[model samples]
Target: MRYSKFLLPTSKEAPSDADSTSMKYMYRAGMIRKVSAGLFYYLPYFNMILRKVNFRIRRGMEKLNSNEMKFPILVSQEILESSNRWNAFNKEMFKLKDRNDNGYAISPTNEEYATLVSNLFVKSYNDLPFSIYQIQQKHRDEIRPRNGVVRAREFTMKDAYSFHADEKDLHDYYKLMGEEYTKIFADLGIKTFPVLADSGAMGGNMCHEYMAISPEGEAEIGFCDACGYAANLEKVECKDIYSIDGTYKNKYDKIETPDAKTIAELMNMLQMEAKQFVKSMVYNADGNLVMVLVRGDRNVNEVKLANFLKATNLELATEKEIKSIGSVMGFVGPIGDLQNVRIIGDFEIKGMKNFVVGANEKNMHLRDVDACDIKCEWADMRFADENDVCPKCGAPLHVSQGNELGHIFALGKRYTEVMDSVFVGNDGKNHVPFMGCYGIGLERTVASIIDQHHDEKGLVLPMSVAPFKVDIIIVDTKKENQVKTAEELYNALEDAGVPVLLDDRSERAGVKFNDFELIGVPIRVTCGRSIENGKLEIVRRDNGETVEVEIANAKDFIINMIKNY
Candidate 1:
């Protein structure tokens, strides 16, 4: 492509609204433009890169015998309601109505339709293992989408679903897809690690998210260095490392706390460490009020709590609910005259003796409270932190931020059973087929590449996904020798099937060079005064290594270098 004819707009300054590095560089490089919050106009350059990512993902799916297909972007409300997901995704789904007043939603995913397809085609155990996939746009109404395309409302995703006859087949296929995902991300030039994830709203017992470690990521990961145990913060286990001391140090008595409503204020008044206090948190789990107890220094892992109670909706109890329970907000306790509510305590509380707790009355606290005084069931309900040891190996944990690029789930008949997608087994009995889901975000993958592989200069894009492999610059468009050499080289490279960009515009050399770097082509060939010497200046964008090659050997040399990628 000739620079003068192409709509390649390059800028030196990042947009003011750009928050993340990928957003900044992508905007400045003219690859994308913001249309609104969480929405963007993916320019031609961005589309090219997305297509390359799709190519890699398709190749990987093809290896697994997963046929590529397309599904309707708009799914009917009846189909979603059949799977009991219409209400689960009401907040995030974009709902609309047709002329007849029937409701439809832009699909956030296609599991319902994929399973329907399976039911239509697969009838017996002979067709037990079936897989299909699609590359299409998925929509979600994100409340606060940030990080550019990394968290956009509308983005391209490669989602695949596989149906099998039994649990064993589903398990085997799930493992294969996980392995294939590793290869796919590796081919895209992004390093990712799989972590145990909570299958929220997907209705699955087993799932894993492929996370790319980045500071700008929204997901938090807790991992162990000793035994290679890793999981998402919501799913990581916090082992019960405490044991009963069997010593009561102080007498249990009530004290006038006098308006100390918070842990910090109580600590300041009582002059006690955070670990010596028991925090009582009230939550309404699926409309049933419950009290949870954890140490003051810890936080409740609501995901874990919800999984334990098997509740669909869990949130902090409202002030009215707390008042109805006869407990003041921030002063609720498990030991008080609580009625008709389940009390659950963290496992660590069993070993804590003479700890402090609220009196269930305003401006009052119970001092020297022991485990024997509290009535509750013990469970692991605290979030894992650096201070917590890995449940697999007793080693200190490390927590870091990560972005989810892909996820694979062993759905285990979650949709097939509900949708009545059944197949006749060899025993002549109808059975629900076990299902598996795998997905990768195309735009998010590109954003992660930019986040992981960029420098102060501009993007340091990987050769496999770069839109153009070589950028040919005409330092002086007026110079006959320079323009002639640049055009010849550009044609030669293009004829050789190498994507090349020729900067033949009437612009300064520095401006052309800067734009070339910003676009992040792997190789740059400059046709300047050096052409008079029967040579051209070649620069490698990755390392800034410059070499002069004879005009006769330049095309072959550039093609050979790209082959090494």
Candidate 2:
């Protein structure tokens, strides 16, 4: 490719709207242009990255015997209603009406469509374990899509689905897809770890997300340092080390606490540590008053709380709701024989003894309270933090934040059963097929690759994904010898089956050098005064290593250097 003719619009200044390091560098490298909030124009260089990523994903799927196919982005609402997901996914789903006034949706995913496809083609158990995939655009109506391509409204996805006649087959395929996802990430040169994921209302390792660790990411993960147990923040569990089985010095007793409504105030007044107090929080779980208790030092992770209680909505209880429960706001406790309203306790609560709790009144507390004396169900309902003991091996966990690049899930019979799509079994009866889903966000994956592989200058793309393998720079385009040598080298590299970019523009040497680095071609060759000496200067982009090679051996050396790319 000739740099002068190509649409490589390199810029000196980064865009103000970029929300991450990758986003800024991507703009400066001319891989993308911002069209609107949450929308972008992926330039030719960006398309090159997408093509490579898509090729790798397709290769992975084919190895697992999955057939590639395409689905319409705009889906009829009838399909969603058939799958019983219309109402459930109404919010965050983009709805529309066509000319005939029929409701439709810009598909966020292809779950229902895949089921519909099976409804037509899969007629017998002989077609069991069917796997199909597609690389296309997906949409979401984001209230606020931040983090550049990391949270875009319309982006590319490589989504795959599998149908099995039995649970074992589905489970097996799920594992296979997980392995394939790991391989895909490896091939892409991105580091990833799979963590436990929520597979809807059902739970288990049947669902997992391949997360790319990055400091600029948005998701949090907790991992065991000893047993390799890792999980997302919403589902991670720490050992119950704070629960007290021994008795306390004093039994439950009323104590005066003036203006000590908060935990910090009470801790200061009683000269006690945060672990000595039970932090009781009031919440409205699906419009019903409920109390969630955790240690004062811990926080209630609402995602876990709602999932545990099977609540559709979980938010802090209004003052009116708290008052109606015969409890003071900020003073509600699991004790005091409080009735009607349900109380839920964290796993840590079981180990707490002789702890302080609210007395169901203002400016008062119940001291020396044992959780056993309180009526509540205990479960893991708090965020696992740093230094928390690992539930698997009792080692301190290492918790960090990251970005998810891929996810594979076992859908069980959720869609197949709901849509009443079934196949004739060997038993001569119609039975629903178990389903599994796998997805990779192409835009996010590209951005994460940039995040994982860039430096202060610009993108340091992996050799396999770099737009071109070699860059030929005419240090002085005004010099005829430099131009002829650069063109000859470019033609020679092309003849050797290597992609090379020739900087044929009449620009300054410094400008050409900066642009080549920003674009990040893996190898660069300068045909300057070196050509007069029967030599060529080769530069490795990753390490800036320079070597002088005889002009006759330049093509073979460059080919060998980028052969593994």
Leading candidate by TM-score: 1
Every model's TM-score: 0.96, 0.90
Model 2, range 1-565, lDDT digits (tens) per residue? 9998889899999878888888888899998898887888999999998899999999999998888999998988898777666655536789999999999998888998888887888999999889899999988878788888889888999999899999999998888899888888887889999998665533223789999999988899989868999888777775555564654344678999988888888889999999999988998886788888999888998878877787765778888888888889878787765756888899888877788999999878999898667777877878988867777878888888899999888888878887888899999998989998899999888888898887777778898788798889999988998888888888988887888899999898889889888988889899889899999999988988899999999999998888754
Instruction: Report lDDT per candidate.
Output: 0.90, 0.85
Span of ten consecutive residues with least summed lDDT in model 2: 197-206
**Weakest ten-residue segment in model 1 by summed lDDT:** 242-251
Best by lDDT: 1
Q: What are the clashing pairs of model 1?
A: none
